[model samples]
Target: MATVKVTDLAHQDAQKMLSIINNQMPQLINQLNSTGQQMSDPNNWDGPLAQKFRGEVWPQAKADLEKMKNSLAQLQQSVQKILTNISHAGGA
Candidate 1:
């Protein structure tokens, strides 16, 4: 049989990381939105490139940023899972 071991320190570290990520995600998303807004501003771009990037690239980048929440949630869930059974094994 195979076994996996997790520790209290690991749980604490995971919790810390999850907390940090949760806190930072909003700021990151805001920055992404700011960038997208800047890209869409006509003053920032003066050529056909604006039609290409603001119309296509910036929009896609913003969409991807929206999807990042789910990915971060999955990471938090994985860490929580590792911390789950650890409590029964003298872990926090």
Candidate 2:
């Protein structure tokens, strides 16, 4: 495969994307946490459906959110490495 050149623009774009992810991820987590709390609260919700949701769906969603966070962190690290490499190469 032909090696693609990494430029300053690419690094800038990657940084911007990472910035967006950093900004939005917390909002997503907060929303999930709020919803989870609401659903888990007996006063707010308590029934067979709520029990099933609290037992099943909430955990899966939380786990998936954690996985997504890990994946995004990996992506950010990879991008940082690429940016560092490009900087050392004097390409950015």
Tens digit per residue, CA lDDT, model 2, 9-86? 887887787786778876887798788868887799889999998899888887888888889888888877777787
Worst 10 residues of 1 by lDDT: 81-90
Candidate 2 matches the true fold with a TM-score of 0.75
lDDT of 1 at 39: 74
Question: Which regions in candidate 1 have their CA more than 4 angstroms from the true location?
Answer: 1-4
lDDT of 1 by residue, 1-92 (tens): 86767776787987788776778877888887897888789898758988888789888888888788778888878867766666656676
TM-score of each: 0.71, 0.75
Query: Which segments of candidate 2 are over 4 A away from where they belong?
Result: 1-4
**Candidate 2 collision pairs:** none
TM-score of 1: 0.71
CA lDDT scores, all candidates in order: 0.79, 0.81
